[model samples]
Every structure is written in structure tokens, then in C-alpha cells.
Target: EADIYQTPRYLVIGTGKKITLECSQTMGHDKMYWYQQDPGMELHLIHYSYGVNSTEKGDLSSESTVSRIRTEHFPLTLESARPSHTSQYLCASSDNPLEQYFGPGTRLTVT
Candidate 1:
């Protein structure tokens, strides 16, 4: 089973503060991904990693950046926060399509 976790399940900050959304998985999956979601809306892929030391920006445009230095961890950071950046970010890892698992997301609200 995929065991994934995210810290600071919810966040509220001003327009200029920086933030990092943390994600970790215990299933040892090499493929990790980050997705941005909005309430009652579709999800958009923002970043992904194939394995350790390998990372790629996803199809959607985002102000956040991610790193994959370990097989079980992928953390994303934003240099500066803005009201337009508020949303839910989900972390996921998978060994295969059928084995994919998602972390409980981090909800961010920038004022």
C-alpha cells in the first residue's frame, strides 16, 4: 500500500510570505507527483519526479518548485505567496497506475 503524508494540512498567510509543502511516502515509489486542485474542480498536474535526483515540471503552469533528492520524499516551495496562488496541493506516488496513492493535501490560502 502507498503510505503518503503531507505536513501543515492547512495554511493561511499574507501576500509575500514563502511556503513549502512537504510530502513523503513509505511505499518507496520512484514516481512522485504534485497536483494543484481547487474546490469542486478538476486537478492539474504541476510537478513530477521520475526518481531520485530527477524532476520535471508538469503540464500546468505554477509558481511552485519541487525537488526529489530521496526516493520517498518530494517537497515543493514557493518563493513568494500571492492571493492567486491559494489552492489545495496534493502529493502522490506510484509504482504503477493501479498502485498509485495520494496524500491528504495541503490547503493554502494567501491573503
Candidate 2:
């Protein structure tokens, strides 16, 4: 498994707050994914990429955006956060499609 990390592991912000959830890995995987999950719910894929500058939206629709400028970093940003955006954001990267390493996850609360 790759060494993956997410900054500000837990966060609480007021409505309309702008926030960025950072994800990074040291193994330099070329494929990355972002998934969101509400407490006790199944994860929903919101974004993914195969490589730098190759971004694609996932199964779940989201108000957030992601960028992949480097192979090791993938950041998700909510330009104007709202209460409905509260959830756990998970970042995963893989060298093999069948196996992926995941970050600890960012638990966000928009109040």
C-alpha cells in the first residue's frame, strides 16, 4: 500500500465557507480517485483521474472540483461550501486497477 495522507483530518466550517481537502501519496501512483460518504452510507465516487491533467467526473454528482497537477497530489475543493456538503471525503490511488491505497479521509462538517 502507498503512503497516503489527508490534511486537517477533521474540519468544521460555517455555511458558505470555502475549503480544500488535500490528498497526497508518496508512491507516485498515476490513477487517483475521490469518493464521498455520509455517515453509515455507501461511498459515492465524485472524481477521478488517470494521470496529471486527466480528470473525470465520477458516478456521483458533486459541487466540488478536483485538480491533478502532479502524480502524487490530488486536491478536492468546495468553492462555496454548504451544509449539504458535509461528508467524509476519501482519496485513493492505485497502480493496479484492482488494488488501491486510501488516505485516512477528511471528515467535514458544514454548519
Q: What are the Cα lDDT values of the candidates?
A: 0.93, 0.94
Measured against the true structure, the TM-scores of the candidates, in listed sequence, are 0.96, 0.97
Candidate 1 clash figure, as a count: 0
Instruction: Give the Å shift of residue 6 in candidate 1.
Output: 0.5
Candidate 2 error regions (>4 Å)? none
- Cα shift from native, residue 32, model 1 (Å): 0.3
**Per-residue alpha-carbon lDDT of candidate 1 for residues 4-98, written as tens digits (9 for 90 to 100):** 99988999999999899999999989899999999989999999999999999999999899999889889999999999999999999999878
Clashing pairs in model 2, backbone N/Cα/C closer than 3 A: none
Q: Model 2, 18: alpha-carbon shift in Å? A: 0.9
Predicted structure 2: lDDT: 0.94
Error of 2 at 11 (Å): 0.4
